[model samples]
Structure formats: C-alpha cells, structure tokens
Target: MSNAIDFISAYNTIDSRLRAIYRGKGNLQFSDLVRRCAEFNNTVRKYEDDLLLCARLRNVIVHESKKDRIIAEPCDDLTRLIGHVAELLSMPPRLSVLREKNVTGIDAEATLAEALVRIAQTNYSNLPVYRKDRMIGILNNRRVVRVVGQALERGEDVDVFLQTPCSQILQAEDMNRFYRVLGRSDTVQEAIDAFEDNRKLLAVVVTESGDAGDRIVNLLTSADIPMLIRILEE
Candidate 1:
C-alpha cells in the first residue's frame, strides 16, 4: 500500500506537469496531450512505452472505489519508472546549449596547410567548413589526406598542395557523404538517428535551429555519442 501510494503520487506529479505543458498549445484531452508530448520531443518519445504504462496505472488508482483500502504493491520497476519520468519532465540537456568541449571550425578559404595545422593542434578530426556565416562542408583528415595524395601522384609540388584553398578539395560527393546539420532545438536522439541513418555520416553540426545557413554552434561526432550517453545516464 505504501508503494502504491508513492507510485500514485509520482504519477500525479507527471500528469500535472504534462497538463501544464499542453495547456496553452491546444485544447487537447489527456490522451491527446500525452501523444503530443511524445511527438514534440525525441527524448520524450524514447520513454513513450514506459509513460503509457504509467498512464494506465494512473487510471487504475484514480478510478478505484472508496471501499478498496489496498492497492498494488510497487516493485523495483515502479521506482525506476518514477525516476525516469522525473528526469524526462525536467528536460534533459539540449545539444544546442551543451557545455561540452568548444566546437572548432575552419574557413573554406583557409589554406590546406592551415587546416592541417589546426587539426594537429586540436586533435579533432571533424572540422566544420564555413565561408563567413555559411557552412560549406566538413573537413575530415582522411579526405584531406586523400586530396593531398592525389595531388602528389600527379607530380604536383608539395607546396602547391599546402597552399591550395580548402574548398577546392571539398567535393560535392564528400559533403553528402560525411556531414549533416541539425537545428539547435533538436534533441540528442535526432543526432543519433542522423548518424545511424547514414553509415558514412561522420559528424552533425548544430546550427541555429538546425538550418545550414545559420552559424555552427555545436558539433557531434560518432565518438561524441557514447560520451553523451554517459552524461545522460548520470
């Protein structure tokens, strides 16, 4: 009975928060509000199954007759469920404003040598390429090396390759293969989905609200996801 009371209390808290969230959006019923919450955020969507189960449990407790003094005993699963819902309601970190490592970028007009030097200094493989405010592409070490190798094979002077403009080596095919851009408001799950959907996708650039024309505010590489998962777990 104590566990059931605690579970009911947690469920009510979640339900009230949900109602407050959707109150101004539209005249949605409780069920519709829950659906909309899942639709609006990928993180919330991840907990959809567990949330729905909580909803059913809420219904059972709220509708119980006055004569029923006892309710279902809570298990470890109930404790976990309450904790997860609380975390979700609190709004997990946003990729746009994450306080992780600073994102570094290079100019499209920068010399190949400049980009190489930056890579060596930062040890960051993925670098966003921008021309002023516009993002042109991402420069990865593999592609940069490949371009230099092709130039050397043609008997071109090493100095010529070093002085070449970064954009000159950026093929249209490479941009499509290596990079994707997401909005600032997009959840981390969206970033994960982008990486999973594109096997060759090496990085995701978070722009102002996910637009390519906006300034790159954050960068997520395949390696960053595991770190992000660890942060979320904590």
Candidate 2:
C-alpha cells in the first residue's frame, strides 16, 4: 500500500527473476547477481546503477528498521521506476513495434539494373534476395558500391556488370557475417543484442521460425538502431 512496500515488492520480484536466470548456480549476493547478469543482459546493463542503488536502499529499508517501525520510505517516483524495471525484465518489448508492412523481396536472378531501379523507386536501401522461395541474401547500397568500384578499377564495362544477376553479386558479398535470422517472437532487446554483437551485421530478417528459408515478416537494419535504443530507454 505504501511506497516502501511497493518498492520492496518490485525489488523482490527482480531479485527472484535474477536467481531464476542463474538457477543451479550457488547462492549469490544481489549485487553480484546484478553485476554478472549485466554482462549479458542489456536491460540490466542499462539500469545497472539504478538497480545497485536500489539494492543498497533496500538493505537500509529492511535491515535498519525496527518491528512496527518504518525507518525510511522511497519516493513515489523511485517506487514506480523500480516497478517499470521489473516489468521490462519479466516481459521485454517485442520487435512488433519495428515491424514493417509489405516488405519487398527481390528475385535473385533480377539484374543489377532492375534491382537499382527498384531500390530507387521504393526507397528501401535493403531488399531481401530470394531464389525458389528461399531467401539467399540482401541487396543493399554497400554491396552495389563494392561491385561498381571493382568494375571501375578493372576498367570493365560498368554497364556489362550492371547486367549481372543479383545472385551473382551476392556470391562475392560475405553472407555469413552480414545478416542474422530472428523469430517474429523475438524481443527488441534481442534485436539490439544481435546488432551489438556483430559489428558487420547489415540487417536482421525476422521470420515465423527464425529460419532463413522462411518468408520474412520483418526486417531491421543498422539505421533502426537509434530508434530501438530510444524505445528501450524510454
């Protein structure tokens, strides 16, 4: 009912969740748990200072109090802040907020010229390339630039190269390092982690089951990182 009670309840919830996260490990201190989880959990890392301070405040509220006597009460704002942190840790915001309707996919065999025209017309810098209904790679400006730069260096007919197939150009693009697959159910935090973990990642394709072969339901590019971060911080 009181701010102190509300604060303690949310703090306990966060504590329990942290223990569950590292279940089977030896009993650990709350500060230690927060520190260790921060290494892998972006939410924890983002609010590390606040959580640690709350832990200390929690000790004073409980340990320093006498029977039937409250020593200190947390402010209403602090109570609500902890409550929000608990809710986020329990159920993070999913990628649905970033979902794009009518995602366009390009045929792998489409010529570079056609792809460029589509890119220019649609204003979509990244387009998934598919062959036989299976996604092979993405067509992005960086890939096009690289191909054109190489053509000019060799004095090869740039027009001839523009006639090359999207699939052909994809072969020279580093497929393994440029993209990742995530399920539609994945949270925004996971998407942020995917981009953070791979500096070279160009895009994240979301599908029904996180398989590259599945039809893409949503796509996230580096351009969306700032927006995602804002969502989390907000």
Candidate 3:
C-alpha cells in the first residue's frame, strides 16, 4: 500500500482508540482528542506533537487533491513512527513483557528476621507479605527501618522486635495509597504512569484479575523504572 494509505490507516486507528476512551461524549475532533487524551495517557503525551503534525499532514493529503489524483504522501519514516504510536496507544505491552518469574513473597507469620533473610537472599528491597496466599502488603526496607528506629527510640529490646511477625508491620500499611494493583490487561505504560503519579508508591502488584485478594503474577518496584522506560522506548 502507498505511504498515504498506510499513514491514514494508522491515524484512523489512533483516532478510534482515543475516541473509545471517551465513549458517549459525542464525536470529538481529531486534534481535540489528542489534546484531551494527553492529559492522562503517557503514550499520547509523548507523541502529542507528532500526532498533531500528522493531523495537519493528513489534511494536506486528503483535502489538497484533485479528482483521481493524490496530492501528497507521508514519508516512510513518519509513517512508521505514527504506526508505532498507534500500536502503543491502542494495545500497549503488558506487565508480562517484563517476564518476571519466581516473584518472592514472605508469609505474614514469618519473623522480621526471617523476612530480612529472604530479602537478603533475593536481593529484593520490596517483598510482598502474604496471609493465606493473599497479598496483604509489601514489607520494604524503609518500613522495616522505621519500625526498628522507633524501637530504638524507646530503648526496647532490638532482638525482640526482630522476632516480631511481619503481620505487625503490615498493620501500618495503607495499601490503598502506598501500593497499586494492576491486572493482566493493564499495559506497561499504565504501570509507568502509576509510579510517575505517586512518588510514595512502594510497589505495584500484578495479579491475574487485578485484585488484592488474587495471587501476585508479578511485582514492580521503583528500581524497575529504568527497565520499564526502556521497554516503552524500544
């Protein structure tokens, strides 16, 4: 197919997907759609200028034409760029793209010392703590340090605190604020946005159905931010 045809096809795909996000809001102009979607969608925001330029170029290609003659065609490079943007906006890579395996979790009944040992062994700063196979909260090093510091302030027996169950630590976790849950359908861009939106986010839990009650399919820490950005860029 001609570059004009290919570019138009990709542009339509992006238009359709953006409109779907705001269904029942009445028909929106193409430029308006890009501007509004950019407010929440990282992919759109990243390619906002390119997409707007494509919109202008599309007008030139479609309107400045005579009967049975094409006026302009998008260059091959621009065509591919818009096509890539369309794919990302429409169906972005999921958490599975990370191919995370053997995601470690500690039992809530386990001692802080045991949890520390597991953290050391796995070299993961954020460890999911579970009760009855359901994830309750993350036992990250920050929380551990805070709890220990408070113990020292009170001059309590440090060893006794180390022996305390992880469940005690989980009690202080405000799961709704400090952590997020994303399901299988969630995209990698969404995960990136989640971290970008919340600086205090301890971890992002990926489950089969995006519920806290569901077993974790994967876990994301801030340390994974660089890799996540690389995945999106590539």
Error of 3 at 103 (Å): 2.3
For candidate 2, give the lDDT of residue 54. 97
lDDT by candidate, in order shown: 0.74, 0.86, 0.85
Scored by TM-score, the top model is 3
How are the candidates ranked when ordered by TM-score, highest leading? 3, 2, 1
lDDT of 2 by residue, 1-234 (tens): 889999999999999888876564788989999999888677788989999999999999999988898899999888999999999888888876665657787899999999999999999888889999998888888888998899999999989989999998885346577888888778887888888899989888888788878888888888888888788877
Find the 10 residues in a row with the least total lDDT in model 3.
169-178
Cα lDDT, model 3, residue 75: 91
TM values, all candidates? 0.65, 0.78, 0.82
Per-residue alpha-carbon lDDT of model 3 for 48-145, expressed as tens digits?
Answer: 89999999999998889677777997899999999999888777888876675578999999999999999999998878888899887888887888
Q: Name every residue pair that clashes in candidate 2.
A: none
List residue ranges in candidate 1 displaced over 4 A. Answer: 1-80, 86-92
Better of 2 and 3 by TM-score: 3
Cα deviation of 89, candidate 1, in Å: 7.5
